[model samples]
Target: MQIQDLPYPDPGVPDARSGPRFLVWLGRNQLGGQLKALVWGLLHFLSVSALPFCVGFAVQAVVDRSGARLALAGGLLALCGFGIALGDTMLHRAAVTNWITAAARVQQLLARRTALLGSALTRRVAAGEIVAVSTGDVEKIGWFVEAVSRFTAAAVTVVLVCVALVVYQPALGVVVAVGLPVLALSVLPLLPRATRRADFQREKAGRATELASDTVAGLRVLRGIGGEELFLDRYRRASQEVRHAAVRSARMWALIHAIQVFLPGLLLIVVVWQGVHLAREGRITVGEMVTVYSAVMILTYPLRHFTEIAMAYSFSRPSARRAARVLSLERATDGEGSREALVPTGDLYDPATGLLAPEGRLTAVVCGDPDAAGELAERLGGHTAESSELPSALVGGVPLDELPLDFARRAVLVQDKDPVLLSGTLRELLDVPSSGDVSPAEALSAAQCGDVLDALVQGSLDADDPMDARITERGRSLSGGQRQRLALARSLVTAPGVLVLDEPTSAVDSHTEARIADGIRSLRQGRTTVVFTSSPLLLDHADRVVLVHEGEVAAVGVHRELLHSDVRYRAVVTRETDDEAAEQELNQLQELEEIEETA
Candidate 1:
């Protein structure tokens, strides 16, 4: 539970029942740390609560003119001061430990969930929401967790002090006791309103954050489209809405603070007024009156904790709820399969769509709808959206989902249409868990990335070593085709038993696409390769081309056979009429001859 022992071996699955329940679960999970915080908090609050008694005793000693009593009072005061200093220091240490540990536990859980869900996480939850939950929301949850122990200790101190007062002076104690509960409970009615406003503010803030993230991610695209002003205005308006919602939330909380301050002030007034009358009428001594006044003033500190704890709970509840929602998202393959590893070396067959990529064959899937193609590509790698009800993809007569996740991943690598290249040196980017069959040079060559490497290293200090050149975030500094090729190169280096590529060369030129198509076929000569593409150059290179129409296989043949036989296939792959197709074919032939003659 200590900071040094962070990243718990088992950050255990969180209870995703509800917000309040999740918070309770967090407290339960860290019982040992919480107990330490509670003990220190109790000691700290007890020392604070003893200050009034020490002063009251000292006042009585002075009135009695007893040197022995005065000395005893001074000793008690010194002890209380020492306890306050030591207890406060230790309490702060324990509370901070609790906060850090709680936050770390939450972060670990989030990271595990993110890793499990992978790209599907962003599909299920906003990237901004994930960012918010991992950052600000986690801190808020930890703050509430850390505050609970202190709040409990403060409550205990308040009760113990009130009981001691009742024993010391029943009449004034009754007045103080009655007023204390009223002070604590006075703001309860306003809490619902404050919580509602706070939730609204959080909602608005999340939207604003999402908008900002989206805007920044697409800034380059926005500038290209000349839509920067439009997005900027949209973000500005979203930010303004967040500000307005926050102001509304603050107003409600301000009212609650006013009530917290006002009620305590009223209680202090009542205790002072009642004590003065009792002292003047000889019902209580001067020292007793001073004691009652001091007790009421000291009680205010603990009373403020009541409102603070409420505020903490209100903010953390929604944050916890969001975190729980993310944690609750179970992967489609989760809990439905065994942990047995399988080295799949057979065709990847999707029973739902009846699309099969035969083993050791370069199969091209041409789909009329790009969305359907993407889904099929995911299916080829045992990845399905959370909403998908499709049956498990099978390989070697074994369900891919039934295999251990690591085994399944190692067996089939799916490079999505929009693959991400993380910020790192080129060598680090290609350094993935692999079968060690393909070298960096071989993979890069198969991916047709020679031009990309040259571009990256052209003006760099490490010009001779392109692999050492740094890549910016998402490879944003690279061209679209360069990024795609780099992603393809990284995937090729893994050298999985099966590789599913979705539009691997869509961003590249026809000549480069032709080279990549040929290189891929040569590199993956004895492995299963499924390429979802409609490009003629890529389709022509496939050993077998399957035409997918309306989510089902419409035809299966070589690219040329399908073009001549299937009208839908031709429409999809060529995207031209009869005359246009003939004219394009003639132009390509003439261009090839001219290139051959010049060479």
Candidate 2:
């Protein structure tokens, strides 16, 4: 497709077996644009090559004392100049279009891969590396794609010029023809060194980017713990390492450039020296000598493209490889499983943990170990680390892994303990793909975040509408409770078939938590909801409570029933040891005995 038809309706499946293969795939996909650029480039370079011949003819005409020949030569010269201008302009336009379109296509492909993988992408690949691939590496890949056409035109024009000179004047032509290839091959030995240095620099830069990202993401926590300075120092060292690697890379490229300049100058001297000797010996005339000298000078111009192509390949190779590495990652569920439509309206079960949450009920999971709870929550939502050894969580009788990714996502929505709120208008943040049954305002009230709505409306210039208020990235500007409550509202608005919430009200106070728990029961009535929490406030409101101990379901019953009947369950939910629980139980018994005596 042409550049105007860009943002390809589909970026197509990439052959990400290797970086070089990926780059080749990109070039093949954009062959139409590349050919367009090549055609324009040929016109431009051919016009330029013709200028030396026109000057040679003009000199010959002056020597012959023929005004007619002079006029003809001048006319041809002007016509060639106009062709050069037109060709150069169009060539640039075509090349740039190729560049932008290739970059856009790669970007679209990356976006699609990211969508398919979701948070798993970052888990498998570094956030920094992904960022580098999408931002800097994308441009490098485009540069190589665009350079191919121009390099082709330059090489073809160089060959044509060498042949024309051989036909017109073989004695000096043979020398140039042989020397041109030598000049082009001179930088081959240094290319590997340059490429290695560039790779190292890219790696260091990626690490520095990752470090900076992590530091910023945890800046608030770091300050509270007084460790920001330590991270800053570490980042400074990373930046220095990046700088040193860059300088080394630049040195190698600089040396290659120096050879590019020095070798061409040497070739020009040899051609001019031989031409002068021929002129003095009467083997060739004065005009012929000038023509040969000017031709060599013009030949140096196209020869420079040889080094440019080398540099482009060197830079883009590593970038394409990194992009390929990222695209090669597959989601945990991306297997050869049937994507048949499955309308699962029964209980959600995790066979690995033997945990079951019945349909049309609010089930509260009490896990004292936060990490285990998090892992269980992920399983309940059909998410786990890349391993596929364990059977996937099932909805009804169908495995979530067998269902299509989009359908599974719609079927179960999981809000982790730390739910993130992205930067946007309040309205935009809540406008997720949802069932459309729950309004944003109703969700907000259900989340007990009415105060958050008030704060946004008052802080915003558009005071009349809280929905218009903008949130900073990760809702960093708001308090922890505000961000948590806002994220809860957004999740409630989704109104999924099964909602898995992990400590959804951990950041809020007891009173607020109680209201949120009641709201959740009211809003999610007659729907399956699994909440992983130890808070008595939320567990007290659950239709049924399941206790998980040591990665297995230990007990399941009503909240009060489990609290009184199972000592382990009571210890977990109450955040106490069995000894402490018994001591408290004994104190209660003694108080009852004294009350009976007083009565």
Candidate 3:
């Protein structure tokens, strides 16, 4: 495929059986491109292989003192030159096209998988591993794929040259043919050791990459805790380990290279010695001996490709395996069939925790464990894995999982505790695909993001409109409270039928959070809204509060009623007992009396 035809409409499902199997699958998928590369490679290698014969003929003509034959030899040499030039150029073009197209196809598959898997992709694979696979690993796989054609052409050329040599002079041809195989096979014994070292190097490099990614991701936190040096030192050691492993692997490859050179040189010496003996015995003409010797020398180039192809395979095998592992991860669903949209007019019910977020009401969930609360929030929005044993979340009493993923997501929006803000302008960030009933201004006001807009306006001198102001990656330039509010505003703009928010106001102060809680309730008056929080300010504003203890719903009632009746609820929401409250109140009164007496 051409570069312009990129981002294939369907990258198509990969085999993902094993590393070698994946390579085979890639080759199968790009048969036309492979064939093009093979044809070009054959033409190129054939041109190269024909050169020794031209030289042999030229030498024969010179010995015979035939001007006509010499002129013919010159013409053949010119033709070979033209063939070499055209074949080399086109061969490179074809090989590079195959490499690029293969890489692009794999990249598209990765992109599709990432989109399909969403947040679960990160959970299953390390961020650095994913990065490495997409970047370096893809290139390695492409290298092997591109090498296949060239290796095939080289092998064929070697065989043809050997046969021609045998026809010209049997004794010299047999010696060269037998020795060529020895030179190629001698490196086989060293390959296992080299492969082991390469695998070790790859592992170390992956670890180093992972460490660097994690360190960079948490750089702000590391600096806050004054632990940058600790992390830096850890990264340093990891990088050193990677370097040492690479050096060891290089050493093994170097030995293999030495063997490749030494064996071929020995083979050339044997061929020359044999040819000299034949020439002395008058069994072969001087020109024929020269041809056999030149042919054997030319065979060296193709024979070296055997070792090169071996190296390419050795390096690419693990990379392909890693890529296959990533591509093999399937979503826990059928992920096919009709995607009928859900009717946006029902209570969100999770059978796992027996928690029901009723229609047109604000339901607050207070779980002792934040993680359980997050998971429950996800389930309520129908984001649970299809493989989960828990029953599907119900919307309007219909199974959420039974509906298509796109439909389910549209029907229920779940804003995670740590929501990400993609880099874009304020307007772009709020432009989500949904019912555009909620204006950006209204959503921003409800989310208490007025200050965020003002900050953006103040930061960008060229921005005539605050909505046009740019946001940095992950909203890193903004404070925690501003980022949280901005994310909430973006979510609100979607205006989904059911909104499940997990600790949406966790980072904000009490006054700002109180405003957000009240604003959300007012804005979503006739919509289903579930807030997973333990904050008293937000819980008190909810129509109904459900307390989740362990993994099940422990209590359900108004926030005030729970505070008065359930000690566990009080402990979580208020984090104080009645005795402590009384003690604090008495101490305040005593302090007031002491102040009056002093006055």
- lDDT (Cα, tens digit) per residue for candidate 1, span 127-183: 889988999899999999999888988899889888989999999988887788888
Root-mean-square deviation per candidate: 5.2, 3.2, 5.1
Clashing pairs in model 3, backbone N/Cα/C closer than 3 A: none
Q: After superposition, how far is residue 368 of candidate 3 from its true place, in Å?
A: 0.5
TM-score to true structure, per model = 0.94, 0.95, 0.93
Off by over 4 Å in 1: 458-464, 577-599
TM-score of 3: 0.93
Winner on TM-score (1 vs 3): 1
Task: Supply the global lDDT for candidate 1.
Answer: 0.87
lDDT of 3 by residue, 1-599 (tens): 87678878888889998989999999999888888877887787788888888888899899999899989989988998888888889889888888898999899989988877777788789988998899989999999888888898888888877787778778888887777778778989889888888888888888888888878877778988999999999999999999999999899888988887888788778878887888899988778877877877777777778877888888888889999999998766445514455454688888888898899899999987887787788777766664578877888887766777777778888898888889989989998886988999999999998888889999887897989999988888888889999989988888889999999999999999999998899888899999999998999899999999988889999999988767778778887777876665677689889999999
List the lowest-lDDT window of 10 residues for candidate 3: 333-342
TM-score of 1: 0.94
Ranking by TM-score: 2, 1, 3
lDDT of 2 by residue, 1-599 (tens): 66778779989989999999999999999898889988998888888888888898899899999899999999999998998899899999999998999999999999999988776677688777888899999999999999999999999999999898888889898988899889888999899889899889988988998898878888889999999899999999999999999999999999999998898889888988899888888898777667777887887787888878888888899899999998888878844447676556789999988899999899999988998898888878888678658788998867888888888888888998887788889999999999898999899999988899888887778658889898889999888899999999999999998999999988899999999999999999988999999999999999889999997899999899998778788888777877898897888789889999999
**Model 1 / residue 400 / CA error / Å:** 1.3
**How much lDDT does each candidate structure score?**
0.87, 0.88, 0.85
Question: Using lDDT as the measure, which candidate wins?
Answer: 2
Q: Look at candidate 3 and tell me the lDDT of residue 68.
A: 92
Question: Which stretches in model 3 have alpha-carbon errors above 4 Å?
Answer: 337-344, 385-387, 577-599
